[model samples]
Target: MADALITLEAVSKRFGTVEAVRASSFSIADGEFFTMLGPSGCGKTTTLRMIAGFELPSGGRILLRGEDVTEVPPNRRPVNMVFQHYALFPHMSVLDNVAFGLKLKKVPKQERRRRALEMLEVVALDGLEQRKPQQLSGGQQQRVALARALINNPAALLLDEPLGALDVKLRRALQLELKRVQSETGTTFVYVTHDQEEALAMSDRIAVMNHGVVDQIGTPREIYEHPTTPFVADFVGSLNALEVVIDEVVGDSVVCRFGEVGRVVAPAPHGASSGSTWRIAVRPERVTIGTEQVAFDGGSRLSGTLQQVVYLGMLTQYHVDTPAGRVVSHRMNDEAGLSLETGAEVHVGWAADHTSVLGPASS
Candidate 1:
């Protein structure tokens, strides 16, 4: 955090009786693509608004490049925001729309137009500068908005689900475009989105928020592979949670029993104790299913009956009914086990390192 660009120290926000954000703390590094990701009502948008000076925090402070800006107005702060709705003026051409900010600052007409055209090239919209907002496609309009924001040369760019309005295919494409623009401009991006995939694909680091709390922050791989909380594990990706009772602890591993099937040895989690029951979570893609028993060194295994096979274009999903409960496994469509029929007996296995011991199972 040596070159921290934006810092939130114990930030909290309230809307009358409801607490929207609570004691959230984190920092965005200079020129980094930092994302705030979570489901609706998770207070991510509120946090972004607070940083953009649109909403004030009820407690704590916000810093921009080491200077406290908790009370600064949006126009006075060195930041700009892009909304899901691109908010372009219908009467203006793309070039005019992009140069509007500069016009407001009384920048020379020629200079603003030159900078605006340069930004259009940066966003890959140089050829469409003369088109009105309504004449362009959704993605093109989005780039115009981006160019408009970047034309001002803000220290940080705040985006609140700017791709939320695009179709899945277009959204996926824009995720990369946004990352590229941020990289080329070297402008710090604090993007807010509820889409886990978008956050995972476009972010340098992500802060997963839940019910007003910033649960965890890490790289996409770290967050997906080693989630620190049950909410983080469940919300970020597909997880299969199995309730198991701890039988014993041996060094760095723990023996646990699930249902009447068998025991499993998993890497010992912090605070694990014998006889206590907890839910162990594993991502669907990490679990493998096979008709014949396959030994997985340093892993857990279970026997189950194949309940269903779902064919998704790029991958296949196998649902198996086990003694403990139902578990699902995902594999590429070309994987060998896709031929397994429903009702066939199958073995489910995953490495102990893939298992995450969550909070104690409900009574």
Candidate 2:
């Protein structure tokens, strides 16, 4: 954070009686693609607005490149915003939409046109500069919107779910395109999105927010593999949560018992003690499902009846019913275990290191 570009210090926002965002604090390094990810009404959008100077914080300060800009207006700040909808001028061509900002600044018409064309090329829409917004595809129009926002050379670009409107395939394509643009321009991007896949695919770092609280912030792998909270573990990916009672605490690990026939040795959470109930979670991909029992060194095992097999193009999921409730395991379409039929007895196993202790079980 020595070269922090955007910093939020105890920033919170309240809409009259409703607290939209709690005291949230984080730093975005220069040229980093930082994402605020959560479900709707989680205060992610409100937090983005506060950073963009559209909504002033009810508490704390926002700094851009070490300068306090909490009270700065949106237009005066060296930042630009792109919304879910591409707010393009219906009457103007794509080129004109891009050059609109430069025109407002009263730059020479020739210079503005030259820069607009260059920006179009950067977004891979150079040949369609003369087309109207309505004439282009959803993905193309989004690129135009991106080109328009980045054309101004803002120190940081704030995108509020810019890809939310596109179709699934198109959205997936643009996720990579957006990251490419951000990297090529070397502009710090403050992106907001509710899609877990989108956030994981494009972010250098992510802040997982829930009910106005910042639950965890980390890289995609860190957040997915080592979630510190139940919300993050359940929200970031498909998880199998099992409630268990601690039987013993052995050094750095805890032996927990679940249901009538399941026992697991998982890494102990802070302050873990015997007789305390806790929840442990494992990702679906980490669990292995098989008809025969397999010995796993330092791992946990469960016996269950295969309930269902879900085939999702490149991957498949096996849902098994065990004494501890239902557990799921994921495997690529080509992997073994796909031949197991539903209603057959199966063994589910995962390495102990892949399990995460999610504090305590909720009452």
Candidate 3:
């Protein structure tokens, strides 16, 4: 925790009557790839802008490396940003664009050129220094933008949806490139994006934000596997949420008494109370859609009518309607799944370990 390079204590941002970011508290360690991930209007970009000195928090202090930098100007802060649009000057060549920051700082002509070329080479954009932004491809232009930002050697790099403009294949490629850049330089990166896949693929730690508040912050595995809230469980991946009332608490496990679905057993989340309304969340991959009932006791099972079947090449998804209403389950395209068909009666069951008891479904 002492290695936290950026610390936000009780940070809040408001625009008139609308609250953009709540009193959020979190920290980013030195050299860590931290991401602020959420949907549009979730205040993820707002948080990044605050840290980059583009916007000041309405309240709370912002600290960098144990120093209060709340009042620091954007240029004075030890940080640089790569904008979503690349923000490069079309008139300038790649070399001049990369060296623009150094020129602003009054770096010597020779040294600035040397550093700019070194950065261009680092980003694999060598030999294209003479080309203007309009002359370069989208990916090439992005690399130039990165080189320009990194040439300054800031303590941390802030990226605001840097890959939003690229195509799918190009975005995937740049995700790898960005990860490689972060690893090679070992510079702390604070990236903001609404893409969950990008965050899962690139970030060392992700802060899932919603309604201007940090919903959850953890490693990719932790965020994907042990989600603390239904929003997180549903947002991170495909989930089958079933509403059930809790019947009894047996040690660490809870027996949920579903209306027409019958008894189900699953691990209880912390602070779950007996006889309370809870939801059983199971991933699509964990659900098994079988024509007949599988002999698995001490587990949860539901019988439903298979309504539709979607062929996804590697896997087939079956939509079923049970007493708990409509639910979707995933199955591989193997022998066990070859006979799956719509309008067939099937039994969907999951092991206790695979089902998570998320208390109370959101309205």
Candidate 4:
């Protein structure tokens, strides 16, 4: 926190009857790839706009490197924003587009051109400096926009769904390129996106927002492996959520009543008590296929009827209807899995460590 380059202290933004962003407080470290990730209308883009000084918070403060800039105008803030549109001048050459901000600053023409060319090389657009925005590919134009933003040398770069306009393959390619450029430049990046995979792939830390509030913030691995809330568990990846009642606590685990799932073992989280109800979450990859007579190694097991099997080359997804509930299992598509099909009776088991237990889902 001491090294945070940007900090939001109880920031709130409202428009008439609706609050677009609640009192969100978080910090992005110096040279960190921090992301605000959520679904559409979750205020992620609004938060980015606020950081870039495009939206003024109705309450609280916005800090940049320990200085309060809560009331700073967009032009005065030490930040720049790149949007999905890439907003390049249609008639200007690529170099001029990248150097437009410098020209406005009255920076010497030669120096501005040098910096613009350097940034273009950084973004792998060296050969297209003379081309117009319409002359280059979508990805190239995006790189030009990134070059334009970075050339200003802002304290932080705010990106609002910058890859949203590109096709899937181009988006994926540019995600890596952006990551590489960030690493090379060591500039603080606060990116906004609704795509979970994009956030997980690019961010050093991610703040997961929902309904105008941050549900959780953590590294991708931490969020995926140890989600503390049901929304985070369900949003960050595909997983099964089951309603169960705690039967008892044994050693370091809890025995849960899964109705027809029989007695099941789950990791005992704090605040859990015997006879209490909870939501059980497990990833499809964590559930293993087992036989009726086979005993699993310290985990929950259930019997089910295979309802569907989808073979996706690398992995196979099995939809099973168990007495307790329907669950999905993901297994590597190896030679042995070739025989699996719908209508077959199967046993599924998941390790307690791989399970996440949360409060009951809201009504």
Candidate 5:
């Protein structure tokens, strides 16, 4: 897009014998909250570092606000970063820590303090500016880190797992807080994390990465509901898989014979061939289980033995053994006023449209 605030064009990075990032190309639109998400060693952090100018790309270019910044040093780029560890100086008070970057750039003493205090207020740390890092709690230190980064008022802010250090409750709180701050500033944010829920919760769009390459890039809803690949389907949420033998291709739909589960119809995945073996995938929440036969609106249904039942406060999850092997089904605690029990004979079903046919699993 023309309004992209940051563009990475065919960028690749190598370290000695290993390639840390492949030919990656993506654009973060102006004032958008974009995230890079993947498991460890998936090149998410390397991609962020290249954009930050901490690590140079071996090929292609990096552009910021329509200007080529591939050759620019870290300090020269119009960007600031909040590190995973906060990277706050323990010896310095919050004010000094936030003002350090401005001072390094030769900002005037009085102006730096003014900007620092303003950002501290922006991050809700106005009164605690004189406290050292050790004197503050984990969440407080994170806010200070954010204050320091935002004090520069850069075109974009880069966060590398910024909430990874806090406890679960605090991390959740900061996630929302960070989102609010980003909206209030209207500054583009490029966040990196391995947590799928965090990405889905906070990102306007997410680039799912694997094996040093971007596997898919889309809105959180697109990545979740219509995953383009098996990796994306497996990575983005809980999945249930069924092995099936493809019978034929009927237009854009594929007819498949699921083992011990009978025939099912699913939309053929792009590039799939007729009569080829495939794996059918469905999300756990998409499956419905009941002691009686349930109407199939658009999904395939089958009978399974309830092997285990786990009762969470909001929902009940059942581990079912079916002809297609083990399947996990989740039902809302109040859905149909039904309560599932172990050893129950239940029929499981889902809309056919929810089914995804994938490449046959490797033996």
Candidate 6:
């Protein structure tokens, strides 16, 4: 991590008796789209503010481009933050708003207009330079704010839920737009948001935070496919859990007894002990339900009664109550396919490799 653009070494933040951030540590590589993702009150915003120099760390250090900036003032850090609320000046045109930062740094009048116009063009808002903030749409105003922040060419850009105000469609649109802008500029972006889908869509990597502590940090695929902790597995997506009692641990595999349903064999999770209780989780899409028996290695099949059916346009979600436990299965909707009514008997199953052994529930 010698080339890390930003590094937080055991950074923590507190307000009086309440601790907002724990001793969180991570590094962002140069030109990477990194995200701090979690629900509200998870200290993601607090960590972002600490990096922006708006909130001083209670302990540990903050480094930007190899320089220690733990005590640096907001105006002095080599980073800029874009807030959810677009604090644009109503009296000033888009061009003027973008140029305001350069002006404060004593940029010349003619040069200000030139640089401002150029940055506006970078944001695809060149022709709208003369429009005031009041006359622009919400997304347009956000672009103006972004252009203003990027005019200084900071080492990194810190965004605090910048798209939280836009409508769903608009937000989705801008997610791609922002990714394009970030790629085009080649600036490291440390984006903060609570939206897991947004993080999966735009981030090179994500740090999932919970209760002022970072639970896991990894690529979207890794976070989804192999969540290390129960908190991460449950929070990142919808998962069905099955409690099992381990009969024995054979090498890296464990033999789990599923009561009268059946016995299952799966790879033991790292650090799992022999003859201990564990939870196995599978996604709804991974759970298959049918009256027909399927053949597959390391797959667990159980009998269940279909309890509920929810019809979505693309897929049908079936909830089943099994001897092992309740499970859900998702099947694609097809024009000529048959109908599986509720209260019917069905067999539920999934590949053991698709199963993940979750950490203790209390973790």
Best by TM-score: 1
How well is each residue in 1-363 modelled by candidate 3, as lDDT tens digits?
A: 889999999999999999999999999999999999888999999999999999999999999999999889998899999999998999898999999999999999999999998998888888999988999889888889888889888899999998899899999999999999889989899999988899999999999999999999999888887777877887887888878767788888888754655456789767777767777788888777688874457787778899999999998899999776677888888745358778998888777888876667555
Model 6 global lDDT (CA atoms, 0 to 1):
0.88
| Model 2 per-residue lDDT tens digits across residues 125-186 | 98998999999999999999999999999999999999988899999999999999999999
lDDT of 1 by residue, 104-137 (tens): 9999999998999999999999888899999999
- Compared with the true structure, what per-residue lDDT tens digits does model 5 show for residues 140-179? 9999999888887899999999999889999999999999
Listed per candidate, the RMSD to the true structure in angstroms reads 1.6, 1.8, 2.3, 1.9, 2.2, 2.1
lDDT (0 to 1) per candidate: 0.91, 0.92, 0.87, 0.88, 0.87, 0.88
Any residue pairs clashing in model 6, and if so which? none
- Least accurate 10 contiguous residues by lDDT in model 4: 289-298
Candidate 6 residue-wise lDDT, 116-208, digit = tens: 999988898989999999999999999999999999999999999999999999999999989999999999999999998999999999999
Residue 358, candidate 1: how far off, in angstroms?
1.9
Superior candidate under lDDT, 3 versus 4: 4
Q: What are the TM-scores, per candidate, against the unseen true structure?
A: 0.96, 0.95, 0.92, 0.95, 0.92, 0.93
| Comparing 1 and 6 on TM-score, the stronger one | 1
Candidate 4 lDDT over residue span 193-262, tens digit each: 9899999999999999998899899999888887888889989989988887788988888887555555
Which scores greater on lDDT, model 1 or model 3? 1
lDDT of 4 at 198: 97
Off by over 4 Å in 1: 258-261
Colliding pairs, model 3: none
> Can you tell me which runs of candidate 6 are displaced by over 4 Å?
259-265, 271-274, 335-338, 361-363
CA shift of 326, model 1, Å: 1.6
lDDT of 3 at 202: 99
After superposing candidate 2 on the true structure, give the runs of residues whose Cα lies further than 4 Å from its correct spot: 257-262
Q: How many residue pairs clash in each candidate at the backbone level?
A: 0, 0, 0, 0, 5, 0
Candidate 5, residue 106: the lDDT equals 98
